[model samples]
Every structure is written in C-alpha cells, then in structure tokens.
Target: ANQEPIHVQIRQRKGRWIGHTLRKEPSNVTQQALDWNPQGKRKRGCPKQTWKQSILDKLRTTGLTWEAAKKHANDHKKD
Candidate 1:
C-alpha cells in the first residue's frame, strides 16, 4: 500500500494540529490548553515528561522557541 509509516503519519498530524492551534486567537480554549499547567501537588520524585515539555524538546532540536514556532506557523509561505 502507498502510505506513510504510522509514526510518520502521527507526527505529521501533530504538527498540523499544533500549527492550527497556534494560529488561533490567544484566548481560544484549545490554544490555552497547550500551555496549561496543572495546579495539584505531585509525589516527590522525578516528574514525568509532559506533552508541552516533549514538544518544547523537539522544537529545541530545531532551534525554535515557542514564539518563533507561532510565527512560523502563522507564516503561510513556509508551509
């Protein structure tokens, strides 16, 4: 079958979803969710990596900050 690997497809979908969310108004619920921080206490130990942290780590590899990513996503020419 002519299709991308499942992981590749998932990555592409995530990128597109993030880009779409970034282009939304700052007050948008979905946009706000991206940077949301939990308020509850956690067990004392090393914390698990969060989705936001994971995304930030990936972006760091590409040398892009959150603001830069937002700008890039907003720039239709780069797509």
Candidate 2:
C-alpha cells in the first residue's frame, strides 16, 4: 500500500491559511549572525578609555612599570 503525503500549515498576509508539503533549505551562517541579538540592544556611548597606548606611555613617563600600568588600567576598568 502507498502512504499519503505530509502537509504543513502556513499563514498568508491577508488572514488566509494554506497547506503545502514541507521542504528544507540550506542554512546561511552570515544571515543568522546578522539577525542574532545576544546583547538585546547596542551600547551608546564613548568608550571609558581613549588612547590606551598613550595612557600607557604617560604612565611609563611617570616611572610606573608596565605591570603597574596594566594594574592601573584594570582598576580603571572596574569603574
């Protein structure tokens, strides 16, 4: 004996319903990434620190070691 085909329900723009056989499509990663909203909304502000390298340079000029500068940078990050 032969089996009947499966059907899927779809909605149309004008409040109409229709049924058709289901088909699979190839996945698109780029489109998927573009649609994703993991953060919910975009951040809107200037970054906390500008001229990171220049800040390090100034810290070095003040006799602070690179390790000390890095620590200071991390501390500033907490605020």
Candidate 3:
C-alpha cells in the first residue's frame, strides 16, 4: 500500500496548524489559548502531560525552542 500511516498524517496536520497559529497575532484568541496555562492544583498521583508539553518536547528533539519555533513558523509564512 502507498498510503501514509494515520499517525503520520495526524502529525503533519498538527504541525501545519501550529505553524498557522504561530503566525497569528499574539492577542489572537486561538494563539492565546495555545499559550495559556491553568493555575490550579491537580488531585494527586502522577501529573498528566499537557498538549503543549508534548509539542514542546517534539520541538526540543529537533533542537528548537519556543521562540525559535515561532520565528521559524513566521518566516515560512512569507514564502
């Protein structure tokens, strides 16, 4: 079969969406939501990995920090 795996497709789409979000104004509601952090305590036990955390982890694996990734995303928008 010549099809991409579902996970691969999902990852590609997520990356595109994140890049689109990064290119938006900081005050944009969707962008704000991406950078938002809750200020409440969890019940207990192991803490869950947040969506932002997972995305950051993937960026780190590629040696890109949040700021760098944002810049890269914005730069690509010009092309």
> lDDT values of the candidates?
0.83, 0.36, 0.85
Judging by TM-score against the true structure, name the best candidate.
Answer: 3
**Candidate 2: regions farther than 4 A off:** 1-50, 72-79
The residue ranges of model 3 lying beyond 4 angstroms of the native Cα positions read 46-48
Name the best candidate (by lDDT): 3
Candidate 1 stretches greater than 4 Å from native: 43-48, 77-79
Better of 2 and 3 by lDDT: 3
Q: Which residue pairs show backbone clashes in model 2?
A: none
Per-residue CA lDDT of model 1 for 4-50, tens digit only, reads: 99998987888788888988999999988888887777788958666
Clashing pairs in 3: none
Worst 10 residues of 2 by lDDT: 14-23
Candidate 1 lDDT for residue 11: 75
TM-score for model 3?
0.81
lDDT of 3 by residue, 1-79 (tens): 9999999899888888889998999899989988788777887895766677888998898888988978889889455
* Residue range 1-79, candidate 2, lDDT tens digits: 4644332121121111101100111255532432344534445784334333443465576787646644443444222
Give, for candidate 3, the lowest lDDT window spanning 10 residues. 43-52
